[model samples]
Target: MEKVFKVLIFTDLDGSLLHRDTFKFDEIKDYLKLLISKGIFIIPCTSKTEREILEFNHELGLNLPFICENGAAISGLELLNIDLPKELILSREKDDLLNIFKNKVPINLQNKCKWVFEMDKKKQSLVFGLEDKKLKMALNRKYTIPFIFEGTKNDRNELSRIIKKDNLYLQEGGRVINLTDRVSKAKALRIFVRFFKKNNKNVKTIAVGDNYNDLDMLKTTDFPCLVFNDKFTLDEIPIDNLITTNKPSPEGWADVIKMALVKIDKN
Candidate 1:
């Protein structure tokens, strides 16, 4: 008899599981809990900082294993197995990466990048669409720097080129771009899948996202799911059996997850 495949859902937070503007998920709260009760794993794999993800889990009342900072680190892995590491740090420190940026990148390109943390609280709230405690959690990052690029397309491209030369990346998001190390959601998911497969032998991954930065993580999964985003389009995505929904998240997240589960059962 063939062994049953353990399903693992690696999901993006903002614009996928949470509403883009409000950042709430009341619609799918019960649905997520139901899935969790069924022994399925819903891992939040996101560009969010560790504190932000922790705040998310706090609301859920579960200490779920998570990959944060666009896969710069994995936390709570030991919950799955005592032998597994409690926390895994996969990327360079945020300050170290910034130091490299300061030394290698040109002054003109650097000036074009507006660091969000340095901004006033009101401006930070405006840019992130988060306020007070949420805003503070979002800014508590260890491996990535969020910034607004106030430069032309050519300048943005030049900055990306220069960052790439130094083994760094400028990940594009909706309103803000992030400076990350070589680490990415895809790379992090790949590592977790490798570790998970050791015991399960047969496992299937479902990745959900709604932004350009999420494309790689989506591509790395057995089931690539896309949520509705007016700001994001799927014209360039070439994955087979890619599930999508017209309804925006958190409804869209439930829609795609249900679709992926059905597809899994049919296979």
Candidate 2:
């Protein structure tokens, strides 16, 4: 007989799980709890800082491990008392990455982009569409530096080229662009999947996202979901098993998860 596989759902936050503007998951709170009760592990794989992801974990009462800073770091295994093969961190430290950005990026390009941390509370609130308190939490970076590019497309491309020369990269999310070390959500997911399958030979992974940064993670999962993002649409991903939700999240998030759960049960 074939062994039954445990299911793990890895999700992006900004425009995939939380409402892009409000940043609330109230609409799908119950469904989330239902998945947890059904023994599905919901891991938030996001560009969000450790502080922000912790806040969400506390709010949702999820003790599972999480991927933070666009796969720069992973934590919470100690909470679950699970020892892994190795540390799950993939990117350089936040300050180190920032130092590289500050040194490598040209003064001209630096002036063209508004570094998020340089902005005051009011300006951050306006740019991020978050309240003062939430913006404070969002700025707690330990790996990635989030920013808004105020330059033209050509300028942004040029800036990216310069950053790449130093082995760094930019990831454009739903609301902001971020600079970080050579790490990606997909790389972190692969590490976690290996650890998970060590305990359970049969395991299935699900990934959901709604933006360019999420492309790699979405492609890496057995079940891939493309949530609707009004801000940007993803190009066609060459996954044989892919699902696109009808509406944007948190509605789309709930819908896709429900569909995945049903399919998992049937299988």
Candidate 3:
């Protein structure tokens, strides 16, 4: 007997799903609802903070896990899971890391640039601050980090250097370096997949994103959807199972999902 497969859609928010500036995408709501009706899981994976994701979850009425802070944290409902896997704290002593950040590149923030920075305060992860236009602009830039990290190779090297040997994985997201001694997007997703495999009647995994930062999760899934646009520098790697949206941002994302599901049905 062949088992039916279910689908999991891990969508990136910034350039992948929403419009660059305004985070409004209504055209895709119906498609999302249709997927939900068919028992498909839609997970919004992003470099956004928990608070940022919460707002989206609220608006979309989605209760699935969200990848926030560049996979540094994966949360659902009331339970918050950190990739670090350590005793969660506000901040930690990262004199070496801090020094590297200071010397390599200026934080590139301005007075007007607002942000809710998540940093280690006493070995715990903490989030604080208001939004700033400067920070917003920095996040919108191609690379959010100090060094020239633009691809999987560059990112892998930098991750090895900046983090302690014990703390291997790191996420350079939005405008912050999510440093963790523990897990990664791909790893966390494996866990999520296990849960789905056991609970769901059928399961499928779909990953969507538009930047270098999304490389891990995109590679992890069976389907990697690239939200094509001019701003993002995507990999030229040949992955046969990819869904390139017809339109960038809201419209494109909507079209890709609906169209992919249609194609899935056809085949």
* All candidates: TM-score: 0.97, 0.92, 0.66
Give per-residue CA lDDT, model 3, range 1-267, as digits (tens).
555777778888877787755667777777777878887777787766566666677778776567655554555622222332222222223344444544543243222112223223321121212245423432332112222233466545654575444443455554334444354566656666665555455666778877767777888987778887676665576657778865778888876776667766654
Which parts of model 2 are misplaced by more than 4 Å? 79-81, 85-87, 236-238, 265-267
Off by over 4 Å in 1: none
CA RMSD per model (angstroms): 1.0, 2.0, 8.2
> In model 1, where is the ten-residue run with the lowest total lDDT?
76-85
Stretches of candidate 3 above 4 Å error? Answer: 1-3, 77-170, 174-177, 180-182
Better by TM-score, candidate 3 or 1: 1
Better of 2 and 3 by TM-score: 2
lDDT (Cα, tens digit) per residue for candidate 1, span 1-267? 765778999999999999999989988989999998998999999989899998999888888899998899998877777778888899999999999999999998899999998899999999989888999998898899999999999999889998898899998876689999998999999998888877788898999999899999988899999999998787866878899999998999999999999999888
User: Candidate 1 clashing pairs?
Assistant: none
Q: Count clashing residue pairs per candidate.
A: 0, 0, 25
Q: What is the lDDT of residue 147 in candidate 2?
A: 87
lDDT of each: 0.91, 0.84, 0.58
Q: Is candidate 1 or candidate 2 better by lDDT?
A: 1
Error of 2 at 38 (Å): 1.3
